[model samples]
Target: MSSATIRCYIGIGSNLDVPLEQVKQALLELRELPESTLIQHSSLYLSAPVGPQDQPDFVNAVAEINTHLEAHALLDELQALEQRHRRVRVQHWGPRTLDLDLLIYGNESIQTERLQVPHPFMTERNFVVYPLAEIAPDFIFPDKTPLSDYLANCPMGKLKQIQI
Candidate 1:
């Protein structure tokens, strides 16, 4: 793992097993990650499911962290957290007990078999983009485009912020 610290944004969501509590617990777990410091987190929001309509609505939030772990290692830790929550991958964009996505990793653009920085679908997902903009309003994409640019095209849809 690189000794250099990188700021990362993690997108959190859950629609099963008491989603509100699951997301809350995930934020707490993020604070305890080895070699990482939780910087700030966005307010939780409720949004309609992105894929199948048969599932429950999701509770979402974004967290900022500074970490000494390499990108893949960070990914490993995030997945481990998911496993601890009993996350299952039975369908695409399916209901999950917990969903933790590495939305951004500093300014680096990473692409490998196991991970992709600046999560490919982030810009199009209001749940990801809105919560991200909440915590990092001035954040620019690794490609140099301002986040506000995406906000213009991505409608808020049914997303609603919830008081925790």
Candidate 2:
């Protein structure tokens, strides 16, 4: 019997050098991952940097994908992509050439030494929720709350759609 497809949401962002170009490139790269297909993507948004706010504003988006890989393997692929984009690990939430986060993984809850599923902070970031809602308006939180309801109550920042 064929295994059911896993639905995943990924958060992408860039704030160093050519931010838009990096986002575009990251999307294309995501489309190329093995055993995976890019399903939907939200428009890009420009947002003030979170965490350490000493750097440039970020260009962010969320993408929905269908994949066959298990969670940690997917995380490995994301990290490999980050290395390709020259992502630096020197600072928390620092400037980056590309940032790809596996925000949700088929309702699975994972806690590991190097990874976390259902991303610990997805709900609090417009960079994540807005794009997610654009694609899957009815997505449910780990707590079983409707995403649309959360979006309705969220004070997320303005997000602009940029054509790829």
* lDDT against the true structure, each candidate: 0.96, 0.87
Clashes of each: 0, 0
Candidate topping lDDT: 1
Error of 1 at 140 (Å): 0.6
What is the lDDT, from 0 to 100, of the residue 83 in candidate 2?
A: 95
lDDT of 2: 0.87
Q: Give the per-residue lDDT of model 2 (tens digit) for 1-164.
A: 11668999999999997999899899999999888999978888888898997898889999999999888888899999999998888898889999999999898888998788888888888778888898898898777989988688767766566666
Poorest 10 consecutive residues of model 2 by lDDT? Answer: 155-164
TM-score of each: 0.98, 0.93
lDDT of 1 by residue, 38-69 (tens): 99999999999988999999999999999999
